[model samples]
Target: MSSATVTTHTDDWVRHLLFDRGFLASMKGESIKVYLTMLTACGGEPDRSVTISLRSIQDATNLSCPTVIDSLNRLEELGLVVPTMRKSGRVKTYYIPGVPPEN
Candidate 1:
């Protein structure tokens, strides 16, 4: 038995749950990009908080701050993301709840 086997065969059931809840429907281009970025931070703990700054998302998505802000607002309106105060006393932090990996 190898450690890699356990890792590779890990049963990630989050995808099925996301599908049941309609998160897959929102997986489009930019939306999917941002959602994946946040979900990656979840590290299989989908229920945990996935916080990322606007600048980080902007860099990853190659989108301007305003564009990212608009997209985030849209996601917030859809109840996918919630805005929260940052612990570092800097810009606002975004919390992506139960974010699903891109399709």
Candidate 2:
């Protein structure tokens, strides 16, 4: 017989997103995909912030530009993701909820 071990980090927000019936049920598939992609990009940083371009998100999720934009909007509306910075020609910074912004 063989045994396998698994390690996991405690991310209550992720748990809520995955197991909370009301919240999980309210999310669209594309929105979930985008959120997960952003989480991967952030990699559990303390601030949970990621500066990524729309093209990068599209490439990561294999979603169209418009679709990615819509998903971002949905995430923002749901208070799951917040845009920390936006510039005319620069990648936007998004912060996942549950972390206080550094001052």
Candidate 3:
């Protein structure tokens, strides 16, 4: 008997926090976009540190830089996203907690 090994790719999967009542009730659409961009916009990797760029977030959410900043501030204020000192070159990153898969 011969058995073939299978390797499944997880690079296409991303994780994010659930939009529960309290979270949804509190966050605006812009803020939500920011949340989602952080969640799935980055390359689906296992790293807890999300190394996404502002341009990437803006492109994913179709929001202006100022709007994205506003949303990030709101998310940070509400403890949805935590900015870390970690930086990939000049880009900033966030440390996600218990983030789930998005696809």
Candidate 4:
């Protein structure tokens, strides 16, 4: 077998859910990238309340801390990822649950 990691074929799915369904297409470029990256990282778990750390996302995406934080904030503003307060003395955690329909 090949030593490469078998990534999930999620591009079409993301396109369908975010674009074809008219959710994220209206978002900016950075916002779209971060949102799609989070969705891809989240996998098939249906728990919308699932939480993750910025460091984890930065490591996964190979992005800097500030970049990850900025993108995450944009997603939050767009009603994509939900932010939660972590008990780590004001450190925050974010959950990339799917967004609601953009009425």
Which candidate ranks first by TM-score, i.e. highest? Answer: 2
lDDT of 4 by residue, 6-102 (tens): 5554555555567777766567666666665666566743234545666767767777788877887777776677876675643465565543564
Ranking by TM-score: 2, 3, 1, 4
Poorly placed runs, candidate 2 (over 4 Å) = 1-7, 45-47, 99-103
Give the per-residue lDDT digits (tens) of candidate 3, residues 1-103.
9999764343222212344325666789998778767766444334466867788888889999899888988988776677887566646878664443333
- Taking all chains together, each candidate's TM-score versus the true structure is 0.62, 0.78, 0.65, 0.61
Comparison by lDDT, 1 against 3, better one: 3
Better lDDT candidate (3, 4): 3
Superposition-based RMSD of candidate 3 using all C-alpha atoms, in angstroms: 7.4
What's the lDDT for residue 41 in model 2? 92
Model 1: per-residue Cα lDDT over 1-103, one tens digit each: 6555443311355555446667668555676677666666656554556657778888888987877777777677766767776667435666655544445
Query: Candidate 1's error at 78, in angstroms?
Result: 2.0
Best by lDDT: 2
Model 3 alpha-carbon drift over 4 Å, by segment:
1-21, 42-47, 86-90, 99-103
Q: Rate the local accuracy (lDDT) of all candidates.
A: 0.64, 0.78, 0.68, 0.64
What's model 3's TM-score? Answer: 0.65
